[model samples]
Target: MTLLKAKSILSKDFRIGRASDRLFGSFVEHMGSVVYNGIYEPDHEAADEDGFRKDVLELVRELKLSVVRYPGGNFSSGYNWEDGVGPKERRPVKLDLAWRQVEPNSFGLDEFMRWTGKVGADAIMTVNLGTRGIDEARNLLEYCNFPGGSQYSDLRRSHGVRDPYKIKTWCLGNELDGEWQIARKTADEYGRLACETAKAMKWVDPDIELVAVGSSARHMPTFPEWDRTVLMHTYEHVEQLSLHHYIGKRENDTPTFLAMPLEMEQQIKDVIATCDYVQSVKRSSKRMKLSFDEWNVWREPDVPYTPWQTGCPYDWVKFHMEDALVFGSALLSILRHADRIDIACQSLLVNTIPMILTNKGGAAWRNPTFYPFLHASRYGRGEVLRLETESPKYDTKLYTDVAKVDSVAVWNEEKGELTVFAVNRSEESIAYELDIRDFGNVSFAEHLVMNHERLDAVNTADNQGEVRPRAGGTTTLNGGRAESVLPPYSWNVVRFNVQSA
Candidate 1:
C-alpha cells in the first residue's frame, strides 16, 4: 500500500490559550438507569456506605472529570428541587414528563452533591426554569449555597446538612428551545426568565457563575438568531451561554461519519461569532464564554420500556470503535477552541449513551468510547498549541477538502510535556511528520493507538478489553523533528518530554 503524507508544525509561541480544567467535564442526568442502577444502587455488592457503586466510581475517577453537571439535561426543566431533598422515604414521587419515566425521588439534590464529592468533581447545578421560574431558581440556589438564616437554607440545615454545598457553577435551564422539552419556551420568553433568574440566584449567592440557555442544537431553525436574541437579553447578567449537540453515523458512510467534527468545529466558531456580535451590539467589554455542556455521539437505542417505570432501562448504546474515533476527533475540535469554550460535558455519563455502563446487580464495564475520553482527559491538558498542517484531502458529500489526518497539540509548560492527538480518517496508512520549533530539545515518549479491524466492534461487561487502546505505531524523534506511520482508521496520542537547550 502506498503511504499518504501529512505534516504539522508546532511552536511554543503559537498558543491558543490555557485549556480550562472544566473542559474535561461530564454530565449525569436523572434519566433512565443513570441515576438508579447506573450510579446509585443500594443492593449491589460493590455499593458504598452512601449507596453509590464503588466499581463505577473507580471508572469515573479514572476520567479525571473537572465538573459533573447534575440532575439535568431535560430533566431539570420539569424538576422540582424540593422533591429530591431531605429524607428519601418522605420525598414525593412524580412523573418525569421529560423522558416519560417515573422519578422515585429516592436520589435527589443532597445525594448528587455527595456523589460529586466522592468522585472529586465540582457540581454544575441546573435549576428548574420551565415549570418553575425565578422564585424556584433562587430557592434552589439558597438551599445549596446559603449558610442558613432563610427558609430554604434553614430547611437545608433541618435536613441535617449544616454547611452549604457552595456550588460555584449554575446552569439556568436546559434546552428550553426544543419543542420536545417539558415546558419549552420561545427565545424571548426563555431569555427574560433566564436573565431574571440569574439576577435572583446571584443575589442569593453572589459568587456563582451563570450559564444562559443558547440554541439546543446547531440545526435548530432558530439557531444563531436564538443565540443572538438570548444573549441580547441576558448578556449583562450571565457569564456563559450553553450549547448542546450530538452527532451520529449517517447511512454507513465511514468517511463522512469521521468528518463530522468539521460540523462541530464550524458550530463552535459560529456561536462564538454570535456571542461576539452581541458584545459588539451592546458595546460592552464583558466577553462571554461558552459552555458546550451537552455533547456526544448519540444513536437512539431500539430498546423499549414501559412508560412511568422507575429506573427504566433506556438508550443504552454500546459504542463501537468507529464511534470512538469520531468522538476523539470531537474532543480535538473542542481543544482547538479552548479560548472560548470554558466548559464541556459529555452528556449522560452512564447507561443512557454513556462512556461506562453497569449491569443492574452485576458488573460495571466500559464502552469503546471510554478510552478516547480517558486519553484526552488524562493528557489533553495545559495550553493548546495551534498547529499549521498540510495533508492529503478528500471531499465528502457535506464537506470539502476534509483532511485525511485530524490532529491537535497541547503544551504543558509546568509538566514540561507536549502531547499530540491525531486521527487517521482514511483506510490507508499515512506517513506523519511533526516539526517542533522553539521548544529546544524534546524526546518522544510513547505512541498510543486505538484501531480495530471491524468498524462495528463493541465491548460488553464480559469482554471489557475487546476494543481498548494499546502502545503501537512506528514513531521516532531526532533534532526537533518526529516521524510516524499512522495506522488506517485509528485514533492516536503521542507524548514527548520537552527540555530547553
Candidate 2:
C-alpha cells in the first residue's frame, strides 16, 4: 500500500485568535431521558446528595466542559421558567409539546444551576420566546440575577437561596424559524420579538450577554436572510447569534458524511458575512460574535416511547467510530473559526445523540464520539494557530479535491505547548509532516489516535471499552520539524513541548 503525503507549516506569530473555553461547551435539554435517567436519577446506585448521578458527574468532569446550555433545544420555546423554579412537589407536570413527552419539572432551573456548579461549568440559559414574550423573559432574568427587593428576586430568595445565580450568557430563543417549532415565527416576527425581549432582559440585567437565534441549519430556505434580519433587529442588544448544525451519514456515504464539516465551515463563514452585512447596515461598530450552541452527529430514526411517561427512553442512538471521525472534524471546523465563534455546545450531554450514555438503574458508558470531544476539551485550548497545509486530495461524490488529511493547531503560550489535531479522511495511512517555524526549540510530547477497523463499532453498557482512544502513531520531532504516520480513517492528536532557544 502506498502512503499519501501531507504537510502543515505552523508559526508562533500567525494566530487565528485565543480559543474561548466556552467553545468546549455541551447542552442539556429537558427532552427524553436527558434530564431524568440521563443526569438525574435518585434511585441510581451512584446518586449524589443533589440526586444527580455521581457516575455521570465523573464523566462530565472528565470532559472538562466550560459552559452548559440549559432547559432547551426546542423545549425553551414552550417552557415556562416559573414552573421550573419552586418546590419539587408543587412543580407542575406538563406535557412537553416540543418532544411529545411529559415534563415533571422535578429538575428545574435551580437544580440545573446546582448541577452546573457541581460540574464546574457556567450556565447559558435560554428564555421562552415562542409561547411567551418580553415580560416573562425579563421576569426570569430578574429571578436569576437580581439581588433582592424586586418581586422576582424576593421570590427566588424565598425559595431557599439568598444569593443571585447571576448567569451571564443567555439565548433569546431556539430555532423559531422551523415549522416544527411550537410557535414558529416569520423572520420579521422573530426579529421583532427577539429584539424586544433582549431589550427588556437587558434592562433587567445589563451584564448578561444575549445570543439571538439564527437559522436552525444551513439548508433552511430562510438561512442567511433569517440571520441577517434577526441581526438587523437585535444587533445592538445581543452579543452573539446562535447557529445549529447536525451532520449524519447519508446512504452509507462515509466520504460525503466526513466532508460535511466543509459545509459547517462555510456556514460559519456565511453567518459571519451576514453579521458583518448587518453591522454595515446598522452602521454599528460592535462586531457580533456567534454561539454554535446546538451541534452533533444525529441520524437515528425516531424511536418509540410511551406518551407522557417520565424518563422515557428516546434518541438513544449509539454513535459509531465513523461518527467520531465526522464529529472530530466538525470540532476542528469550529476551532478554526475560534475568532468569531464564542460558544458551542455539542447537542445533548447525556442521552439523545450524546457523548455519554446511561442506563436507567445501570452503568454509564462512553460513546465513540466521546473521545474526540474529550481530547478537544482537554488539550484544544489557548490560541488557534494558522496552519498552511498541502495534502493529497481526493474527490468525493459531493466534494472536490477533498484533502485526505484535515488538521488544525493550537498553541498554549502559557503552557509552552503546541498541539495539532489531524484527521485522515482516506482509507490508507498517510505520512504526515509538521513544518514547525518561528516557534523556538520544540520536542514531540505525545500522539493519541482513535482508529477502529469496523466503522460501525460502538460501546455498550456491558462492553464500555469497545471503542476508545489509544496511544499510537509514530511521531518524532527534531529542529522545529516533526514527522508522523496517520492511520487510515483515524483521528490523531500530536502534541509538542515548546522551549525557548
Candidate 3:
C-alpha cells in the first residue's frame, strides 16, 4: 500500500471565473435508441403527451442540465431539419446516414424545443454543414428564430408554432475534420462554410452565439492545425470553438485510464494555443472560448460501424464503477479550466453509454457515471476557486507526475456554500487535510463519497443503486481546517456552509 499525503488551500482571491450553467449541458443525438427508446417512447406507459418518457425527464430535470444540444452528433452532419417539423403524421421517414438508424421524422425541431422547454433547459441547435451548407443553415435559423414574417418564419407558424423558438446558441457543424463524417470537409472548406453560415445566421438573429467546429479528437493528425486553420476563417464570426473527446479504456489499466483527464486538460490547452495563434496572425482582439460539446467515457466500437442499416443503431455499453471515477475526474478537469471552457455536453444523455440508461418498455435507471454528474450539476456552481494541492505523485503509462488526488472548488456566494470535489486516483487511502483562507467562519455541511469494493462493480436496471453516493461522516472540521480519509479510488464531495463569511 502507498501512503499518500495531500493538502488543499482555498481562497476567494484565487478564482478562475464564474461557472456558466452551460458547462453542465448534455447531448441528445438521433443515434441509436437515444431518441426513439431513450428519451422518447410514444407507447411507453410512462411517456407524456409529447411522447417523452416522464421518468427520463425526471432524471434529466434532476441533473439540472442548463443547455441541451439537439439533433445530432454525427447525425447533424447528414440530417435534414425540415423533415422532422410540421405534422408528425405527414412527416417523411428517411434514413440517417450518420448513424444508419431509421429516421422517423416524428421528433424534429418543434418536438425538441417543446421538450427542452418542459425540462427547463436551453437548446443549442446544430446545422448540417456537411451535406448542406450556408443556405440550409440560414433557412433553419430563420425558421427557428424569426418572428412570423418571412417565408421560413411563416412556415413555422403553419407548423403551429406561433412564437419563435429563439434559440441563442447554434453549432455551425459537427466533426468536419473526421474522415468518417459524411461529406467531411478540409479545414479551409469547413472554416469558410462555418464563417459564412455564422454570418448569415447572425444576420437573421443577432442574439445568437455560434460555435465553429474544431478537430473531432485531439489525436486527429490535423488536431491543433485544424483548429488554427478553422479559427483563421471563423475567428470573428464565431464565439466558441467546438471540441469532442471520448475517453476510452484499453489495455485494462485502471491507473492509466484514471489519468485520461490529464489528456483532456492538455487538449484544451492545445486548442487554446491554436486559437491564440490565429488571434495573433489576424491581430484580432477577440479571444476564442471552447465548447466541449461531446465528452464521455466510451470504448471503441467492438465491430466496424455498419452503414445504411435503417433500423440498426449503435450498441450500448454499461459503464462500470471505475468509469464513474474517470467521468468525475474529467468533470473536475473541465471545472478547473472554467475560464475557457464555458460549454460541455456529456455525449449521449441516455441509452448509448450515457448517464441514464433505459430498456424498451421496462425501466430507465441512472448509470454508475450519473451520480458524479448529478452532484456536479447540483452543487458545482457559482465561481470556480483555484485549488492548490501538494501530494504524493505516481507515474502512469501515459501520464507522469500524476497526483494521487485531483480536485476543484466552487464557491456559491448566494447559497453561502463552498463545495469541494475531489477524486482519489491512488490505490491506497489518502489522509487529506483541507485549509481555508481569506474566508470567515464555516462549518462542514456534508461529505458525500462514492466508493466500491471492486472498481469493476456495475449497476444494472434492477440493481441501479449498487454504486451510488452515500453520506461520509469521517471528515471533521476544526477551526478553519478539516481532515478526512479519502478512500482508495473514490469520488468525494465535501461541502461547507459559510457562516456570515
Regions more than 4 Å wrong, model 3: 1-3, 300-313
Index of the highest-lDDT prediction:
2
- Decoy 2 TM-score against native: 0.98
Model 3 Cα shift for residue 259 (angstroms): 0.9
**What is the TM-score (0 to 1) of candidate 3?**
0.97
TM-score of each: 0.98, 0.98, 0.97
Kindly give the stretch of ten consecutive residues in candidate 3 with the minimal lDDT sum: 302-311
lDDT: the better of candidates 1 and 3: 1
What tens digits encode model 2's per-residue C-alpha lDDT throughout 1-501? 667789999988899999999999999998889999999998888999889999999999999999999889899889999998888999999999988888889899999999999999999999999999998889999999999999999999999979999999999989999999999999899999999888888888888999999999999999999999888788998999999999878777888888888999999999999999999999889999999999998868345667678888778878889999999999999999999999999998998898999989999999999999999998899999899999998888899988889999999989988999999999899989999867877878899999999988889888999889889578987777798899999999999888866
Can you give the lDDT of residue 254 in candidate 3? 92
How far in Å is the alpha carbon of 209 misplaced in model 1?
0.4
**Per-residue lDDT of model 3, residues 77-185, tens digit only:** 8888889888888889898777766788888889899999989999999999999998999999899889988999999999899999899999998999999999999
Error of 2 at 349 (Å): 0.5
